[model samples]
Target: MADVPTHLALGVEYDGSRFHGWQSQPDHRSVQQTLEDALGRIAAAPVRVAASGRTDAGVHATGQVVSFTSAAERPDDAWLRGGNSLLPAGVAVRWVARVDPSFHARFSATARRYLYVIQEQPQRPALAGNYVTWSRQRLDDEAMHRAAQVLVGEQDFSSFRGAGCQARTPMRCIHQILVRRFESLVVIDVTANAFLLHMVRNIAGVLLDVGAAQRPAEWVGEVLARRDRKAASKTAPAGGLYLVEVHYGDCFQPPPPMAPLPLSGIRDLW
Candidate 1:
């Protein structure tokens, strides 16, 4: 009789500035390739992994979840410590566990959360240049916050999706969106069932325009109604984007959320 494969889940954190993306690509560095290679080494055989989401090139992640089936008999900590020993500095296996065979990393996820950080300053950021998108112009956080609220709930997001997105439907549900500023940094937090290619960046680009007074807050609603990608602002730079978390059912537990300082502001973005 053949041995049944053991299903395992892992949480990963990576600095994506150097990788091509999350998916494996020929002749290019990828988070998947780096991780799978490490896992294969630990298992002493080829192992494949499926992630909760495939993040784009130059986009970072702190709460990425991945799952794989393995025949190797190893304890959970072995997957974590052993994998980290082989991975490069850009990526790390944060945690590992054996999950029920029914738990799939991607499909089982309830929602995904992302955060984009904009450094609103005159000169370019010297300390955190690789981690933030720099903007010289001042941004109105209140206006951006108000404009972002229109994105809540289920709707067609074709206007925000990038070209070559493979998702058959343009419709997606956004659970929450918060735009706030701390010191010189403006952070945009969004949660959704899933995301299309360039959706978050595109949304950020448009909100930046609104905050900069280049467009009216109401224009976002018009853009959404148009369903034309051309009507939206250019995609924001990838450096500022971070995949913050992926939500799962009671079968899995996620890590703690990032805690930032308090934000004070008026209600409307005008």
Candidate 2:
């Protein structure tokens, strides 16, 4: 008799510096491909994984969620420990649990959170080179926060979306955006119902312009109204971006804390 397939969910954390992205590509190494391979080895069969979001190349994630179905019947802890043993140093399965058949990692997600870390310094970061973006120009965290508020609520994000973005619609609701400074690091944390390709990076670019005084805080609203990508600043670097969390309605527990550093109480809007 054939056993019923078991649906499983996982929490993953990875350094994206060494892979192409989270999705599988033809010849390039990707986070998804790596995880699928590790899982396949454990299941003794081919495995496919679907993530809560698809992060681009060089983007890291501390709380990525994924779902898959298998008949291996391995214990939850075994999936966590065994998958880590097979994965590379840059990636690991942080948690694993059995989920209901309806619990999908991507579709079941209600919101996604991203964190962009920037180092404000004349010289580049040495210890955190591949993990952060550096800017020589001074940034006004206050101005950035003010500018980002224009993005709250549902709106067409064509100005910030990637050219190659394939989402059926350009409208997305940004639940919150907070800009703060922690020592030398400036963190931009955003929560959205969903994101278009390169959306957050483009928003960060525009906020950088506002912080540098090249553009007024009101410019963000104008760009949103224009619905043209060229009106916004160039997309920021991928290294600074991190997929911080994915929210599900009732299926999974909260992810482990990867809390931000101490902040300067810059500003944040719910």
Candidate 2's TM-score: 0.95
TM-score per candidate, in order? 0.94, 0.95
**What ranges in model 2 sit over 4 Å off?**
260-270
Q: Count the backbone clashes (under 3 Å) in each candidate.
A: 2, 0
lDDT of each: 0.88, 0.88
Give one digit per residue, the lDDT tens place, for model 2 in 1-270.
897898999999899888999999999999999999999999999999999999999999888999999988888877899999999999988888789998889999999999998898898878777788888878999999998998999999999999999999999999999998877788899999999999989998999899889999999999999999999999999988888788886767655535422222444412
In lDDT terms, how accurate is model 2? 0.88
- Distance from true location, Cα of 266 in model 2, Å: 14
Q: Candidate 1's residue-wise lDDT over 1-270, tens digit each?
A: 776788999989888887999999999999999999999999999999999999999998888999999999888878989899899998998888788898989999999999888888899978677788889988999999999999999999999999999999999999999998877879899999999999999999999999999999999999999999999999999989888788896978766543211112522311
